[model samples]
Target: MPLDTEFSVTVMGLGYIGLPTAAVIARTGAMVTGVDVTPAVVETINSGRVHIEEVDLDGLVSGVVARGNLKASLTVAAADVFVIAVPTPFTDAHQPDITFVLDAARAVARVLKTGDTVILESTSPVGTTEKVRDLIAELRPDLTMPGRNRPGEQADIAIAYCPERVLPGRILVELIDNDRVIGGITPRCARKALAFYRRFVRGACVTTTARAAEMTKLTENAFRDVNIAFANELSLVADTLGVDVWEVIRLANRHPRVNILSPGPGVGGHCIAVDPWFLVAADPANTPLIRTAREVNDGKTDHVIARATAMVEAQPPGQPVACLGLAFKANIDDFRESPALKVAQALAERFGPRIHIVEPYATTLPPAIAATGAVLTDIDTALETCAAMVVLVDHDIFRSVPLDERRGKTVLDTRGLWPDQA
Candidate 1:
């Protein structure tokens, strides 16, 4: 059954995923308290505004705040449900770091009540949710905790793992429309968590063990990473043979069984670029393909940087090179694990003031790029002045530039933005 309107929810980490999630849940008439350690984020959401960019999120947050269905805070508050949606960034050595997830769980445990449902929405390695269950068991021994050992037994507080599968621009719709995989430490725990999601989600909510859900999330991303690696590797091979990769893909994809993903500078976003590593790290000996795919995708960035460098170096010494877009993908402001940013930053570090960056979404240059003397200019200035251009991201604004206007400029289009120019 769907949860009642009177049931409350508290979301930890009011970031890209968390904020949208909080606003979406709030729209369902459930009172929501969004928690974040960042003061700016809390203040922004409380002011009926959004800290991050997403389609229609500003109005939704503003409406929910105005309607008194949502509020923001720095500390965790007592609620019928707690959703941990924090980051699970990997370490420098590519190990899965669940520090944020565990921290959020700790905060929830402090204020946890007998009937509260704790759901972890963070994309994590397998066994992360169980760690949350074990941590809660250790912290609050007074309350009974569910586990495989206690199988099917009722627990004071229900705990589950529920990872979101959302595209950047369509998070709000997907958050509700996407089928959810709700995995619990126990079967009863999964049922308890399902009621909360059932209130808003229009799609089916499948139930399973917590470990399976975690692996499912990782598998989904890893599968994409592997496929993207194939596309990226094909792009490299096509370049070696002086063949048009886009043309090759277009012809190949005409076959009924063939469906090749578009190749980019590299794999990116918080999920595809990071989650696959979790699976690889979990068991290195058994994951040769997954590990190599990660390596290939990462290497594609280095390859991009090299080719872009050559393009810039070919220009006259005094002439600047315009490096377009910084976001991981087109039309989005998110730069998390973005290969485009890596390429831009590398090129800027090499040529310094000779690199002019055009990112319509970014107001200020990333510190690394700006510190190296790369100037942030509009597309007009870049087109007018720079003799060489490297298209890192295929943003709509960049794609609209006509072939006639860029006639005299030397172009290296990584994203296949302007086919005529290519």
Candidate 2:
């Protein structure tokens, strides 16, 4: 390996994944230029402000800017390394939408120089890196690529697939801490990519072919989806039997080898809920567990919605119901694929103008949430005004709220993080 004084790194897309990775690279003493199509995000980063809601991101961005190792741009500039962390959302038919990744590849291709390494960090279909390499080669035919037999006949660019396995709120810690899997189109590709991550990655870089790397990421999440679906399915069965699923899980997991995941309203996130579908969509016959898990999770939102509606129906018609928390999970302000949001929306729609929502972490809601006729209010106001309480997320604020304080209200705890004392 070669020791260089400065590595010019360009990160495409300044969303949750890109921003944190760019900031971390800069923190490791690399010159990182972050590129985003959004002018507001670009401006915010340049001013040392963070638009995302991750913990410690603002400070990280501030530190990176203060050291002059990080900057934001709307266009890509020449760099020794380029990290493509763009979005890979699905289409209406639930197929892999690689438009953003392709655009990012093309963007980097324009400024790509000899000896530059491009790492595709997005969760994608198999052969995605090869597709990116082909896209780059198409744009810059002047560049020579490494032939299978002759490693010496290498191209101006090298490509690898290194998918991120970080949670949204824990991106900063996980980026360096989690064991990474690096898959290169060639053996040389894998080594170069591993070298880049070694600067900050405390975890080991497991090498493999690019297809395996891509499928490994997909399989990791699919495994989670399958396990959670099992728990969810068991929860439904336990619900029918009038048995506490959490208690059942506790007893079952007491055995020497059982490791059961806790059941929630549903699985929700940019990754777990979405990525499994990519595999099932690709090879439906081979991925029955993945398909079933997705079905179980997707079906959970409706189950929660029904439960909330039933709880509301049991109350008087004019009763004001308080919905505690709006984010997908606990303590954070992410609403993407949140079953809590669906339950709240269902209740608000069913109750119509009678839903008093108290999401202490989030003051204003997006348009979709605002359309549900929910009155966003302070926790105290929501508790004081509403007759029924529905605890969605186990946020610290909701945990801090005493059950004794909620005397007259009917509390339906979805997370079961709190006790319901009548």
Candidate 3:
């Protein structure tokens, strides 16, 4: 059943996940306030403009803001429900850093009141949700916390962990349609969060303990990382043996039980590359396979950098070398932890003005690449001029380039988009 009550919602950290979540929840007839530390993000959304790129997001946010169902703020506002969707990036040592999550928790603690539901939607380490619960309990001792409350007693607040499961290109549809695993500090807390999600989610909402839900999100990403590692490792073997990794995988998958993932420059983005390490950090000794998978995936990026550099090196000293695509995945503008970005940055540092980057989605090169004198060019400009090219991302713009246009060019296709040219 849908939630019967009309409740106010406060969505903290309006980035990739939070802003869309805020907009979608606003569609449910709930008053949604999207909060962010950035003044520009607040201003942009308040003016019915989105700073990020996601399909159908700008229109949705615009409509919700115009209809008075949604607004963005620089400060937290009191609401019936609070959603924390901040980035939980790793530290310099690759350890999971929950400082942003903790800061968001403190902010929520200040505004929390009796009966308000606090749900964390960030992908985090196991027990990080418990840490949030503990921090909030300490800050607001006047209110009773679940899991710390006496037996047979009701707590003053509900805290839950529900991770988002959505692809970047299709976040809105998946956000509404995907099943959710709502985990709480207690059974009552889980039920409380489940009721809130039922308001918007078309898919089933299953209840569980907070720790289990946290692990489930990590496990999901880690499992994919492991599969990708196998493909990446196979690609390396094929490269060494002068064989087409794509054709090899295609043939191997003819067997009933074989299903191999495609290889890329390396794993990137906020989830698959980052979440597995959290599990490894929790118990390093027993997580050799997970740890090794991470190593192999990271190594693939270095491999791409080295091989792409060699390709450019083979060309004349002053010849332009085009590096295609920068986004982590195809058809999206997001470049968080992108291997393509890493490759471009390294090549730019080495070749300077000789490197030309062609990312159809990016209007301007990232500052780091731009500072290195790597010019951002269109596909036509890259193909007409550059002597050597490396396909880092399989964006449609790069895929549609015909063979005749690429005839004389030296090409290294990491994404296997042009298996013939590769």
Candidate 4:
């Protein structure tokens, strides 16, 4: 299908995934309106400035906004297509919560027309897309809906699930080039969404049932969580045997058939750390491996906290201990489910003002850490003043520090970033 420049797209939740998707769709000449609840976010994007950080996203959003193709608003309006990209975060019991998804669906329902297509791009549990279809049907009984009506019959509107499959740092490129799985309540619904995505995506858009699409995303993240757990378990075993985990992994990976992932303090981010639990929660009896992986990953954070605190306790009384990097992974400011932040918080709670944090991405310490009297400082200041150091995140700046500069400092390198202790 050729690009439809006249199509109007309204994307809910203009955060990590939504903003980028809206910007890229606008780049294809579609008039895109990004819907976000935050007033600051709405004002920032309308002025061609971004509130969040993503590579090349600011330029893309600015370009699209300047061309009058993209805008941000606090309310949903009439559009040809509606994309719900809100956060489907879990509840206190780790059960998959679809409150945000349903809220977006209700908002979309208010302005839904006969020919509009609604796509759920948020990562959700199985059957969420069908739930969306049901919600819309209840909101607007005049128009027929797909999946609820006869199989061969076409409905007034199309609804589908198309989960995002992109890394945080490379979302802009992946949004255009990555293959997407478009699954709908019915075959016709799938075709309609495929047509919309084909307008901007260079990669293949495969069609399937809505249930399969939701499960596919969960499987992808669960697979990663399981593999990372193996590496993290190995790191624990290596420490017990007095062997360097990084060196062991390097030698073990020399075998052509064997490929092992590097272990960190723990698996973080919204996906790997949280998605596996959805599987376990859905089928507690059958998902033993998934449950174990989640436990191991969660345990790794506790292990890091124990080790870092032990090092801090061994130091002289009142000596500051530097905790480096609070972001979930390297080179990103996202701290969702970050093990580094947990470890830093534990250290601050244990030693009060003696915990010095060096997160290059954050301008100020989080209020909780700040309330504990932790000081957020630069890498040089941390190295010069702190008696002990814990490398929680392997950021580029932390890796570039010379080995000699770390001499005479009590260091617990959880990432194994500084293998050579000079």
Candidate 5:
């Protein structure tokens, strides 16, 4: 199919994934309208400024908005393609919540017309695309949807699921270069979405059933979570045995068949930390390993907090401690489910006004951390003033600190970033 440069796209939710996706699509000469519930986000994008951080996204969004190819809005608009890129956060009990997906579907239903293609790019549980189809069918009975029509009959609109499989810091590059799994309620739906993606994607768009696509995303994250859990569990064992976990991994990895991922304070971020729970929640009895992996990763955070607390307590009274990095991962501003943030907050609450934070990405500490009287200071000031240092996230700047600068400080290196002590 020939690419449609004149296509109009409305992408719901202008957060991390959605905004970058909208900007990328607009670069392909498509008229893209990014929709968000927050008025501030919409206004920010319309002014050619982005609220979220991503590589090259600001320049791309600026060029697209300046060229009049992309705009942001507070409500849905009629378009040939509607992409639902909202969040699918879990409930308090860790059950996969599809309320945001369904709500976005309802909003799209208002402006959905014949021949429009609706794609759910949000990471969702199995049958979520079908739920979206059902909700749209309920709202607009006048039009036919995929799965509701006969085998030989075509629906008035197409619906498909294509989850974003990009890393945080590399979203713009991966969005265009990574292979995509395009699944639909029907084969035609898959083909339609594949064609849309081919307009911009340099990757192979493989097609499959909607459920498989959903499960594929979950499986990808769960696999990483499991491997990470192994490394984290090994870290605990190494600690108990009085050995360096990083040194052990380094020597073991010399064998071609053995490769171990670096352990952190814990698994964080919206995907790996949260997606695996959906699978376990779907079938609790058959997923003991998955459940255990989640437990081990979560437990690692508590262990880090306890260790940091012990180090802080060992210091004399009035000796301030510095917590480095708050983002879940390094070099990004996203702090969702970040273990570093949790550890920092815990330390601040336990030792009021004695906790200083060194997060280069954030200008000010979040309310929760600020309320604990923890001051956000520069790395230089933190290293000079604080008596103890806890390296939570291995950000590049923190990793490059000279060994001499770390002298005389009680360092709790959760990420194994610093050199081995003499």
Candidate 6:
């Protein structure tokens, strides 16, 4: 039976995942109340604008706000559906620190009512949904579980874990287009969740037990973490052996069966680098592959820093160096845990006033980044006068940069963005 009622949904957290999810639910004609701990985020979403960058998110949010289907608040209220999309970062020793999830869950529990369905949409460790169920049960002992069509005797709250797997840049398309994994504490719980998502989801709905679904999400990221580590490790070997890793991968991938991952400065952003440790923290002895992969990817930051430092040391006396790109990857302005940004910081620390940074996407240098004495300059000015230009990010703007005039200047291409002469 499809639950066709107008769902009054409250989405907790307003970052990358939550805001989009809230907007999409509102697009389905359901009334959505988005809650964020940060007051600024609440204000931003309420204004029909977004603080984060995503394709069409601004328009989607604006439309929802204009339609009066979506609103933002600082705390949760009673609702039919509650989605917890908070952060689950790892601790210093690489253990899963789900404090945010726990706090959000407790807050949601405060407003839970009869027949309410609580979905844990944050990427979490296995058994997290069940743990949430237990927490709710402990908090509200009078409510009964939805079983045997009984709906229990008291106020009932159904709990499920539906992991979101969508690309940050293409969240809107993937939200409806990508198949979803829905797992609940009970079969009734699972069915109810599937029915709720079917309203907007164009892709398949994979039903499973809650723990399996949680592990499924963690496994997806672990898979990426491991493959990226293989590529990063290969980069170290290729550098030592004086081989072009990109060329080797290009040839190797020609077999069709062999697919080598691209090596970069380091893994960045929230997903790939952070999710694997959740598994490692849960069962330390059993996840050697996942743990090592995290170490490899995390260590790559230092390797990139060392390479740039060597360039700084080897530069001609008093010749200014230009750093191209600060973001982790090309075409995006996100600098969270960016290896290129770290490299620039390290270079400025070692070279002092000699380093000039060029990040075309960044309108202004962040305070933490600006203190390093890396002046943000335009692309032309950087390429024309700088003695050494180290290409850290493969931004397309740097592709058209005239290296002919830079024949005598040092060009250390860490990104391998330029073509080689025959």
TM-score for each of the candidates = 0.98, 0.95, 0.98, 0.98, 0.98, 0.92
Worst ten in a row by lDDT for model 2: 146-155
Over 222-298, each residue of candidate 5 has an lDDT whose tens digit, in order, gives 99999999999999999999999999999999999999999999999999999999999899999999999999999
Tens digits of per-residue lDDT for model 1, 221-315: 99999999999999999999999999999999999999999999998899999999999999999999999999999999999999988877777
Predictions in order: lDDT: 0.92, 0.85, 0.94, 0.92, 0.93, 0.83
Residue 100, candidate 2: how far off, in angstroms? 0.7
* Model 5: lDDT to the true structure: 0.93
Could you give candidate 4's per-residue lDDT for residues 1-422 as a string of tens digits? 44466889999999989999999999888899999999999999999999878999999999999999999999998999999999988888989999999999999999998999999999999989989989989999987999777766669999999999999889999999999999988888999999999888999999999999999999999999999999999999999999999999999999999999999999899888888888888899999999999999999999999888889889988999999999999988899999999999999988889999999889989888999999999999998998789999999999999988998878899888899864
Q: Which 10 consecutive positions of candidate 5 have the poorest summed lDDT?
A: 1-10
The weakest ten consecutive residues by lDDT in model 6 span 146-155
Question: Per-residue lDDT of 1-422 in model 2, one digit per residue for the tens?
Answer: 34343788999989988999999989878889999999999999999998888989999999989889999999998899999999898877778889999999999999877888999999998888999998888888877653333545765567899999998778899998999999988878888999899988999899988999999999999899899899888888988898888789989999999999988888887788789888987898988878888999889778878878888888887878888888888877788778888788877777767888888678786566688676888888887777888888888887887877787778777676764455
Candidate 2 ranges beyond 4 A from true positions: 1-5, 146-152, 419-422
Model 3 RMSD, rounded to 1 decimal: 1.3
Q: Pick the candidate with the highest lDDT.
A: 3
How does candidate 6 fare on TM-score? 0.92
Residue 366 displacement (Å), model 3: 1.1
Of models 4 and 6, which has the larger lDDT? 4
Task: Return the TM-score for candidate 4, rounded to 2 decimals.
Answer: 0.98
lDDT, candidate 2, residue 108?
91
Off by over 4 Å in 6: 1-5, 145-155, 399-408
Give me the displacement of residue 57 in model 5, in angstroms. 1.0
Q: lDDT for model 4, please.
A: 0.92
Question: For residues 318-410, could you state the per-residue lDDT of candidate 6 as single tens digits?
Answer: 778998998877776777767788778888877766888899878877676677676888888887779788888888898776657567777
Give the deviation of candidate 6 from the true structure as CA RMSD. 2.8
* Backbone clashes in model 1, listed as residue pairs: none
